[model samples]
Each structure stands twice: as structure tokens, then as C-alpha cells.
Target: MAKIKVLILDNDTTSRDILNKSLEESKDIEVVGIAFNEKIALDKMRLLNPDAVIFGNNFNDLSASLFTKKLLEAYPGKGVIIITDSNSKNQASDTIEALGHGAFDVVLRPDPNISDIEKIKFIERNLSSKIRCFSIKKFSRMARLLTPIEETQPYNGNFKPSCVKKYENSKFEIVLIGVSTGGPEVLTNLIPEIPKNFPIPILIVMHMPKIFTKPMSDSINRVSKIKFKEAEDNEVLKTGTGYLAPGGIHLIIRRNLKGELYVLFEDTPPVNSCKPAVDVLFKSAVGIVREKAISVVLTGMGSDGTEGVRALKENNVPCIVQDKESSVVWGMPGSVAEAGLADEILPLNMIAKRLTDLVMK
Candidate 1:
């Protein structure tokens, strides 16, 4: 396989050198160029046409946000990953804004207190993995596939019922979504389409870092009519709101003595190599919501949610999978489909509407 070409952008010479050295250490990645500012980065991007760009926090004299927006608009298909220092003020908000504007992912710079060897190792591990994932052709294809709901099929409000007879008579109390890889983009498009008055609480498990989940929820909340936020331990589950499983932790629902539902965060080891594994949440919901749960497996890179969907299916819960053509990577949803677990396999645009109809009606 050809090496993934990358361009580094940073105003700090030390930072640029660290990233350049760390990234090139991987045989699968090649550092095509390094730029100290927006102008230089744009020129390098135009000349080198690297597969992805590692954008440092400082953009010399230009505005970082403006630079990111222009870079994406100018290059169109190239991926941009943002790097932020741990001590930066409002780093979460900044990272979220960058993601909303089109940056593929965000990685934090190692704390200055760490040893040089540790920092280099951390940078190499994180940056190289992101570069490789972003360079995949499927991601680029999904980016092109994203379009406004109006442009796709109209919402007919006609949805087929679940295959299991138990679900036909049961009322859906919660909506669970499992997504990864292209999740942020998919959520940005799907969440805002859900109306504020829609019934049932929604829980989402999107594979992301500890620092990114809150910001991801905030970004979705800003555009969405229904409230969206990171799930908090012991917080009561409510209708007309969406909860995102915090990154690096497992989110599960539990009932208190009063029979009211609340959120629980687990520090258990990762399942299927995912901390907030979909199976963890789905399995928990199986005991709480039972046949009334509605499960969705969206675009992702692996089969993390397949077992969870199967568990839900065995209990007669309704499962929805994003169709193959609309996904960045069809691993998760495809797994559920192949298992004959999904009740509906629909495109991204129709998901929110179908979900609303199921819960609200």
C-alpha cells in the first residue's frame, strides 16, 4: 500500500519538528511538507496535495478558524486534523468549533510536564493512527455522500413495523444509537432533524476521546431542536433530550428504588476495543427498556455494535441500520444487517424522521 502523505502546520518550531519526526517514524505515513502559518500551509497544500494535514493550534498571524475553513474549501477532499495543547483555554469549545467547520479529528498535545520520550511516543501513536484512518478512501466517499435531507428522498412517514410481535404492541421508551469513524458528521446531519417535541430519550455511543464528547454534544445541541449533552452519572433520563455516552467511559441506564431511570458511567475495561462500547449500553438497555427499546447502528469502522444489536433483537427490540451506500464505513451496521437483526435499513437522511415517527406516534 502507498504511504499516506501528510502536511504539518504549526507556528512553533519545536512543535512542528516533534510532529514531523513522530509522524515520519511510521512506515505507513510520509510527511510531505511542514508550514509555519496559513499562507505557507495553503501553498504547501496546493503544491504537495497531501492526503491529510496536521493543523497546529497556532497559525502564526492568521485566524485559526478562518484558516481551517478556507483550507477545507480550497482543497475540498483533503482531511485536516487539529492539534491543541492541554493548557489552552476553552480548548474543548475550540476543538468542537473546528470539528463543526470540517476538521476530521482533534488530538491534544502531551502535557509539558511529561518526559520528552513519552511526549514523542504519544504524538506518534495518536497522530499516525488518525492519519491512517483519515486517508481511507471510504471516508472521502462518505464525505461526498453527505447532503441536505431535502436533496434526498422526502420523508414519507411510512415505516415498516418491527419483525418481532412483542414490539408491535410495546411503546418505545428510549432510542439508542451506536456509531463511530464518521459518527460526528452523521450525528450533525441526523440530530437536528429530530423535533423538540419528539418523545423518548435518546442515548448515543460514538467512539471518541474523553475531551471530544462534551463538545460533540454541544455542537449537536446548538443545531438541534431537542436538547443534547454528555450523559452524567445519576442524571435522570428524560424525554425530548439526547444523551451522549462520555468518551473513555461506558454509559448505562439503571432504575432507582423509585423506578425512575438514571445514567450510570462505568470504568470497566473496553469491549471490542471500545471504552464506550455499544454492547455495554445495549445490553444494559435490554434489562431496563426491554422490548420497548429502539436501537440504531450507524456508520462506523468495526463490528462494535453487532453483539449489542443482536442482544436487542433477541429481546424483540426494534433495530435500525444505516444503509451501506450512505455509510463512511459499513462495518457496524453491516454486521447487524448480516446477522438478520435490523428491522429497518435506511439512509442517513430518513433515520431521524423514522425515529421520530416511531417514538412520537
Candidate 2:
């Protein structure tokens, strides 16, 4: 297998060295080049053709969002990870903005409290993992494009295309969404298409850090007709409103004494290695709304929503997953589709319309 070539983009010499050393420890990565400015970064990008780029938070001339946008336009498929400070709220907001501008992922610089060795380990654990996942997705896509149409057939095991099910009789009261990896770009495109008077509430659990969730919700709210914000504990769910689970915690839906729908937060250990696991939210709706709810699994890196979708399917709820061609990383939705639990496998552009049709009709 070819190593994932990487280019470091940072103005700070010390920061660049740290990033270089951290990635050097990974056998699967090769540091192809380093750039101290935007011009140099672009030059190296054209020259080296690295598989991914690690962009540090030291640029003075351009904002993260603009830089990410330009970089992506220049090189479409290459993964870009923005490094930000964990203690800086401004950087967190900027990171979310970058994601909205088509950045692949974000990683925070280690907290000051941790030791030097821990900082290196932190970068290795987080940054390296994202790059590796991106590499797998990149190569799989390349393989598909390179294969001849006549020679192409669905694999026997986990890669079989899902049989699409039409839910003509489906009536839904609430929407439950789980996404990761390439969620922000998809949500930014999907949410605003929903009209203001649309019925039913939406609960979203996107894999993100705690600080970024508020900014992410705020970013989406600016363009969305519906009210979008972080979920508040004990607040009643309302129509034309979307509530995103606060990161680093579980958001569970429950009924009040009067049988009204409300949300609650759980500090339980991370399920499927995610604090705000989709399975937790999906399972919570089982006894509360039973089959009245609809679950949508968007693009994400892991199979966090498979069990949740399974539980929902058993209760006769309709499950929709983004098709592999539209997903940035198809792990989560692919897992559900491979398990034969998805009721509808739709493209990104069509998901919002399908939901509106299923619920409004």
C-alpha cells in the first residue's frame, strides 16, 4: 500500500516542527513537504501532490474559511485538516467555519495541562486516525472509478448495494439524524431547504467537540428557515425547530408527566466511542415515540448508528441513509445499508425533499 503523503502548512517554525515530528511517528504517513505561507503551500501542493494537508492556525493574511475554500477549489479530493487551539473559542468558531467551507476535519492542539509526550500522543491518536480514514476512502473511490462498468458487480459481503424501500404509508412526527466526518457541508446544504412551517422536530447528533457544536448550530441557523440551536435539557420539543446535541454528552428524548416530549442529557460513558452516540438517541425514542419517528444516517466515519437503526427498524420506523456515492465517508450509513436496515438510500440533494414528503403528506 502507498503511504499517505502529507504537506504541513504553517507559518510558525516551532508548530511546523511539532506537526512534522508527530506525523513522522506514523508508519502510514510520509511528510512530502512543508510550506510557511499560502503561496508556498500552493506551490508545494502542485509540485508534490500530497494525499492530505495539515494546516496550522498561524496564518495572518487569510481566514481559515477562505483558505480552505481556495485550497479545496485548487485540489478537490485531497483531505485538509485544520489545527486549532483547544483553549481559544475564536479558533473553535473558525474551525467550524472551515468545516462549513469544505475542510475535511479539525483537530485541536493539545491542552496546556498535558505533558509534551502526551501532546504528541494526542496528535497521533486524532490527526493520524483521520488521515488514515481519508486514505481508505480515497483509494476505494479511485478503485470504483478505475473499474470497468461491465466488470463491476457488488461484492458478496459488506459492499452490496442496498435494496431501496418506498415508504408510501410512512407518517413521521420527529427526525433523528446521526453524522460525522463530512457532516457540516452536507447539513449546510440540506437544512435550509426545509421550510419554516415544516412540522415535526429534528434532533441531530453530529460527531464534534463540545466547543464547536454551538458555533456549528449557529452557522447553520443563519441560513436555515427553522430555528436551530443546541439542545437544552428538559425543554419541550417543538415543530419547525432543530436541536443539536451538545458534544461530549448524550442527548436523550423522554416524555414528561403529561406525556409531552422533552430532551435530557446523559453523562454516561461513550457508546461506540462517541459521547453523543446516535444509538443512544435512537434507542431512547423506542419507548417514547415507537414507530412514529424517522431516522436518517448521513456521511460519517464509523458504524455508530447501525444498532440504533436496527432498533428503530424493529419498531417499524423508516430508516434513510445517504448513498455511498454522495457520502464523504460511507462507514456509518454503509454499515446500516449492508445490514439491510435502511428503508431508503437517497442522495444528499434528495434527502430533505424525501423527509418533507414523508412527514408533510
Candidate 3:
């Protein structure tokens, strides 16, 4: 893979320096330029033409949302990742607004009080991965648009959904969706499409900050027919409602003596470097839901859901993966596809329809 050229925009000297040095350590990324403000960043953007822009927590003139909008308008397809202050009271809401304005992803900046080593470690673990993943997607889009084709199809001649075996039992008790990277934007579009009378309860695991889940769920619920909210501990699973795993916690499924399924929360360390990991949620349902569950792997970075999906497949559960042409970052769903675990590989626009077909049948 080619190195991802990155431009850094930060007014804080110390913070900017740390970001530059930490990112420089990554072999997958190259620091093309560094700007102390958005103006200089814009000037360098034309010259450097970096694959992605990193927006620092402190800015002199524009908010992340405004800057992101400007960047996208000036250079469409350039990925923008915002760095938000962890100490800010409005961190969650601000990140959501930034994403809404077209930012690809957001990461919490380490506290200023933390040691320089700690800050470096934080950036290495969080920000670098986002940049690398975003670059893969950016390049993929460029290749698709630049390469001319006779025709476009979901899959090539040798690829066949019919060749894959799926659980024959038609019964489905619940639906599990695992998404990341572009999850927030995708979920807003998807959840509203499900009708109010949808019979099975849906459990969603989205990679996000702990503070963001409640607001995200609330925002989706406002326009969605099915009730959407952050999951509560030991809450009985209910049909016609969708449950989202709270940020920074694992959502587990357990069956009670009455054979009723409910959600449980755990503060366990992150699996696959993600709290509220898709793998954690999917694996939890292996025995509890068995063949009675249908799982969907949507747009995300990394292979978080592949292992869990394998566990689900072993138990005869059906899995649906979002196709590469429709995913924002195809790491998660792409992994499932490569592993031959997906029963169906459909575009984003078609996922809700297929889901309804499977559940409504």
C-alpha cells in the first residue's frame, strides 16, 4: 500500500509538535506538511495535496465543522479527521456535529497534563490507525472512478452468493448490526427505513466514544419509526425497538430462566482495540441466540467483526456484509467477505431491504 500523505492543522505548538512526531513514526503515513492555522493549511493543501487532513483540538478561526465543510468543498474526497478535546464538556456533541459536516472520523486528544510519552502513545494507538484506514478508502475510491469500465456489477463472474451455504432455518429472534468508521452517518440513514411494526429487536454495536452514544441514539430516534436508545443493563429485549451499545462498554446477551433474552453491560477491556466492539457483541450471541439471530456487518475499519461472525456462522446464524462499493471503509465487512462467512454481500442501499425480507419472512 502507498503511504498516506497527511497535513496537520493545529495552533497549539506543543500539541502540533507531538502530533507531527507521533504520526511521522508510522510507516503507512507521511507528514507532507504542517500548518499553524487553517489558512496556511489551505495554502499547503493545494501544494501538498495530502490524502487526509488532521484537525487539531484548538483552532484560531474556524470550528471543526466549518473547516471540514470548507475542506470538502475545496477538495472533495479528501478525508478529514478531527481531534477533539477530551476535557471539553461538549466533546461528544461537537464530534457529532463535525462528523455531520463531513468529517471522516474523530479522536479525543490526550489531556495536556498527561506526559508527552502518554500523548504519543495515545496518538499512535488511535489517530494513526484512522489515518491509515481512511487512506485505503480514499485510494480505493480514486481507483474506481479513474478506472473506466464496460459495466458495473455488484460482483464479478466467479463470485456467487448461491455458492455459499447458509442456515436453512427461517426463524429469526433478533438482528445484530456491527459497524464502525462511517457508522453514525450510515445508521441515521438505515434505522429510519425500518418500519415501526418490525418484529425482531435489533442490537447495534458502533465504534464511538462513550459520551456520543446517547446523543447519537436520540438523534436517530427522532426520525426513526423504531425506538432507538442506548442499551441499559439487564433490560429485556423488546421487539419494535433497537438497542445501541453504549460507548466504552461491551454489550452482552443473556437468556433468563423464562427464555427471555436481555442485554448486559461489561466494563471489560476492549477486544480488537475497541470498546463496544462488534466482536464482543456478536460472540456473546453465539450460544444465546444460536440460529435464531441474523447479523449484519456494515462499513468500518479493521477486522473487528470477522472473528465474531465466524463464531456466529459456526452456530448456523446467517450473516450479511455490506459490499465494498457501498461501504465507507470496507475493512470489517471486507474481512467477512474474504473469510467467506457472508451469506449475502449487498450494497448499503440494499441492506435494509434484504434485512426486512429476512426478518419479515
Top-lDDT structure, candidate number: 2
Per-model RMSD to reference: 2.7, 5.4, 4.2
Q: Assess the local accuracy of residue 235 in candidate 3 as a C-alpha lDDT between 0 and 100.
A: 97
Instruction: Name the lDDT of candidate 2.
Output: 0.84
Error of 3 at 296 (Å): 1.1
Tens-digit lDDT track for model 1 on 1-361?
9989899988888888888888868999999999887778889988998988888876445554566688878877778888886555466667667677677777888877888678789899877877777776434566544687778777663545435334545688789999997788889989999998988789899998777788789889989999999999889988899999988999888888987778899999999999999999999888787878899999887799888888776778888899887887788999998988888888888898778767776
Each candidate's number of clashing pairs is 0, 0, 0
lDDT assessment of candidate 3? 0.83
How high is the CA lDDT of each candidate model? 0.82, 0.84, 0.83
Report lDDT (Cα) of residue 334, candidate 2.
97
Q: Sorted on lDDT, highest at the top, how do the candidates line up? A: 2, 3, 1
Model 1 spans > 4 angstroms off: 58-64, 86-89, 111-117, 138-140, 143-145, 155-169
lDDT of 3 by residue, 1-361 (tens): 7788999998988988899989978988999999988889999999999999998857645778778878888998898898987556465666677776667888888877889988998898899988877766763353332221223442232333663334433778999999998887778777887889999899999998887888788878987999998899999999989999998899999999999999999899999989999999999999898889999999888899999999998788888898887688888999998998988887665566667766785
Put down candidate 2 lDDT per residue, 103-179, tens digits, no spaces. 77888877868776787888888999899878877722422322332354422223213332345466777999999
lDDT of 3 at 3: 82
